[model samples]
Target: MKEKIIEALKRIEQEFEVKICFAVEAGSRAWGTSSPDSDYDVRFIYVHKTDWYLSIDQKRDVIELPINNQLDLNGWDLRKALQLFKKSNPSLMEWLHSSIVYFQAFSLDGKMRELEDQIFQPRASLFHYLNMAKGNYRNCLQTAAINSKRYLNVIRPILACMWIERHNRFPPNEVQPLIEALIMEGEVKRELLTLIERKVTRDDHGFEVDFPIIHDFIEKEIRHLEEYANSLRGPSRDFTATLNELFRQVLEEVWSQS
Candidate 1:
């Protein structure tokens, strides 16, 4: 599968005339809770030639391949990625911290890590995760019998919100580390472990009885995080200048070598 992904990336670069800087697994697989039939959610950041950005017209800044049952491959252009990074987009931040790496070239990861502390917006990230938890819970887990896989969607974001409130930074992308750091050795933690075990061992296709303990935990966290997120002040700095400079540096570094 790794080889197939690498070959596909190479084909994408040649066919589209871009250079892929970084790529990683994004969804349940990277979070360590993927089941046997889980698809590969391959996300990447790529750069086109310098001339491609020198136009007045708005060109597409994303590359998306047709999704199949086994692989979902797509990428963001470098400029688009940097713009999102400046805004501290939680999805982009998670991409940077993904545990599974498919490809990395140049210094994109190092450069982003150096600026992470300065650019991270805790308030924005908190609201993002909080909203995710709320929406997933309301949509997927409000019944007696629920899709068991939906628990991770709610629990992971809630844990991320907890991590942000406690540490004031972006949370880890994987759920295990977040669990270890935030949840104590109690019924909630035990229940979460059991859910994760089931998630990885079998395909999630049917509805099952919901875990009341997990439901209670999710409800309490959502209410608490809403209050905490509202208390945080707005972002303190404008990162446009810093990100602009970095964007130019990457264009120079990537194209100059070719």
Candidate 2:
């Protein structure tokens, strides 16, 4: 499957005439809680040759491929990625920290990691995950028999919010670390571990009997995160000049080498 994903990424680069800076597994697979039948959510960031940026005409900044049962592939243009980085888009940040790396062609991945602290705005990130937690809870988890996937959607964000509150920064993208580091030894922790075990072996449509320990934890955590996020200070620090230099460096290297 990894080989297949790499082949898919290389084909995307060839078809689009761009260079993939980095690619990683996203969604449940990356989160360490995927079912046996989960799809490969492959996301990447790519850069066009120098000439593409020189054009005055507006252009699309995203690449989307058809999704089948086996693979789901998509990517963002480098410029668009950096733009989102500036705004502390949590999804992009998650891509950066994803454990499963399919490809990395240049220094863009490392460079982005180095700038994470400087570019990440805690307040915005906190709100992003908090909203995810709140929305998923309201729409999906309120039922008596919870969609196991939707349970993850709600809990992961709640845990992420807890991480931000504790560390004053964005949490790691992986779910295992968030659970281990934050959710202590208790009924809540035990129940989640049970769910994870079931999820890993179950089919795509697995359902979990609702557990109040999980529910109560989420509600309390959400209320606390709301007040805690408000207490956080202003936006994250900026490093526009540094990012500009990185953009130039990548283009020069990738285009010249090609």
Candidate 3:
């Protein structure tokens, strides 16, 4: 599967005339709770040749392939990625920290890691996760019988919010670390671990009749995180110049060798 993903990325580079600087697994696979039937969610950041960026026209900054049952491949242009990095986009941050890496070249990963502390906006990240939790809960978990995957969708974001609130940093992309750190040894932890075990071992489309303990946890955390996220302040530092310089360096590094 890794080899297949790498080949797909190589084909993307050839087809689009771009250099893939970094790529990683995302979604349930990266979060460590994928069911056996989960599809590959491959995300990457790429840069086109120097001349590609010299134009004034606003070209498309994203590349999305047709999704199949087995693979969902997509990527962001480097400029688009850096712009999101400046704004402390949670999705980009997660990509940088994802546990599964298919490819990484040049110094894009290292450079971004260096700027993570300066660029991280706790308020933005919190709200992003908070909203994810709220939306998933409202949309999927309203009834007594709930989709297990939907329950996880809500729980993971809620856990992320807890991590950010307690540590005041971007949470890890995986779910176990969040569970280990945020949840104590109790019924809640036991129930969550059981759900995750079932999710990974079996098909997640099946509905579980009841998870009152988990539901209660989710509701309380959503309310508490909403208040906490609202009370937090935004990032004070501006990283535009730094990110721009890094972007130039990457262009030089990638194209100079090309």
Candidate 4:
């Protein structure tokens, strides 16, 4: 495993001509429930040469690296990331605060988070979460019976909506924090906790939570969020300009230091 990771890093450094600034396990393994035969969910960031960014044509902002039996490498384009930052993209925010760190810049991701307050647009963020909730609800909630992952699909987005409503900001991706902020009942809380634990203990056929009672509550929240989402207006032109500037800054910074 160690040799495979090192080889993966070397390939990115040599082939992409970018220093892998950070790397980490991002998915089920990082959260502590990976099966024996599970694949590595390696997520990382890279810095490239300045000339590569000087072109007028849009380049691939993010890179999804190839994987071997033991490793899978993927990364966000720093420019695409900053653009998302202005719109308050939750996944970018989660990357900054990911519990498992492969490599890190003390200042870079942290600085981006700080800039979020200045560039934050409530309308853009609301639309983002609402869209995500709708998509996940559509794909996962086909039926109540035999649909095990439906709760997480609904809960994640609803929690994001709840966070946006309460703090007027994006929600953290840590499942517990999202739940802790809203759900206070003992039995309901236990059900969620048990779901997480069961996932950890079980194999990857996808386990179910023992929460027949909680479906109605989740469904109600989803409907409310969908209704509220309809009223949000899109971001103003000013927001796009700010996002572009931020992205340019990130590109320059990465190129210079590379």
Candidate 5:
């Protein structure tokens, strides 16, 4: 798997004319609870030579590869990442924390890791998670009566909301860690876990539909948690200017060399 990913990275990098700083397994696989069929969510950051950005014309800031079997490789242009970093996007924050890194060069990724907390935006992140939950619930749960994968889809963001509310932080990259570290011995914890596990199993087995009780519970929980997250304004989003300076320094070093 490693060799395959490396070869794919090489092909894409050469074809795209960008340097890949790191390619990581960012989704369920990196989170330590991947099923046998989980997709390899390849997340990476890359940079182009000085000419790529020396223009008033719009630049392509993202790289999206064709979806492959059990593997999906994609990347963000470094400057694009930096601009989003300024806004404190949650997905970018999680990308920096991904557990499986397949490539690294010149300590560029290391710099991004160091600037995580300094750039995490609480209010934006909360709204990000909330909006994601709302979209997934509406789209997935609505058609879940004919399919079940959608249940797991809606559940994750709701749990993320719970994590943010309690931890007063941007939440972890992995869903399981947030659950284990944040939720303790309580009815909320047990019920939510059971729902997740059951849904996962059914999805793996290719179940046809969901139990009404389970579906209803998930809906109720999503609503309850959305309300909970909306009410809380935590100190999770404030960016430290010092950290931002550090990020700029890192970008300068990389861009200067390129």
Candidate 6:
């Protein structure tokens, strides 16, 4: 499977004529709670030769391959990545911190990791997580019997909100650390652990009896995080210069050297 993923990425490079700077697992596999049949969500950041960006015409800044049952692969151009980084897009940040790395060119991934503190906006990230939790809850968990996988979708973001509130920074991408830090003791913890176990081991295709304690916790936390995030001052820093510098550096480092 790993070899197949690499072959696909190589094919993407050939087909698109861009250099892939970094790639990682983005979804349940990266979060450490994937079912046996979970698809590999491969996300990457890539760069073209300097000429690709020097044009007056705007090229598509994203590359998406057709999804297969096992591999869902896509990537953003370096310019698009920097734009999202400036906005502190939670998905981009999570990709930077993802545990599964399929490929990295030069120090692209390392450089991105180093800039996380300078570029991350806690308020924006909080709102992002809150929105995800709120949307997933509304869409999937409104009934007495809920899709079991939906519980994880709600719990993770709620925990991420708690992490940001407590630490005042971007939360870690993986769920276990957040669980360890926030849900150490109580029946809620036990239920979460059990759910995680089942979700990882079994096919996450069926609805299950909803757990009230988890649902109540999610509801209360969402309300609390809404109030807390609203009170946070907006991010004010202008990271355009920083991002531009990094972008130029990567282009020189990857393209010039090649």
Assess candidate 3 and give its lDDT: 0.87
What lDDT tens digits, residue by residue, belong to model 3 across residues 45-139? 99999899999999999999998769999899999999998888999999998989988899998989988887889999888889988899887
Cα lDDT tens digits for candidate 5, 92-170: 7777777787888767667766766566556667778778877877786466353434555565666667776676566
lDDT of 1 by residue, 188-232 (tens): 888787678778886445634346888788888898999999998
* Winner by lDDT: 1
Report the C-alpha displacement of residue 84, candidate 1, in angstroms: 0.3
Model 1 spans > 4 angstroms off: 142-145, 203-210
Please give the distance, in angstroms, between residue 38's alpha carbon in candidate 6 and its true position after superposition.
0.4
Weakest 10 consecutive residues, lDDT, candidate 1?
202-211
Stretches of model 2 off by over 4 angstroms after superposition: 141-145, 203-210
Q: What is the TM-score of each candidate against the true structure?
A: 0.95, 0.93, 0.95, 0.78, 0.79, 0.94
Model with the higher TM-score, candidate 2 or 4: 2
Off by over 4 Å in 4: 1-7, 29-39, 139-150, 203-212, 231-258
Model 2's lDDT to the true fold? 0.84
Cα TM-score of candidate 1: 0.95
- Candidate 4 lDDT, tens digit per residue, 98-175? 677766652566666676666666666666676776777666557544443445555666676877777876566567
Error of 4 at 204 (Å): 8.9
The RMSD of every model to the true structure, in order and in angstroms, is 1.8, 2.0, 1.7, 3.6, 3.7, 1.8
- State the C-alpha lDDT per candidate: 0.88, 0.84, 0.87, 0.65, 0.69, 0.86
TM-score of 3: 0.95
Ten contiguous residues with the weakest lDDT in model 2: 203-212
Clash pairs of candidate 2?
A: none
Candidate 6 residues 143-222, lDDT tens each?
A: 65555577889889999999989987788787877888898567778777777877887744564434688778889899
The parts of candidate 6 lying over 4 Å away from their true place are 143-145, 203-210
Task: Return the lDDT, model 1, position 134.
Answer: 92
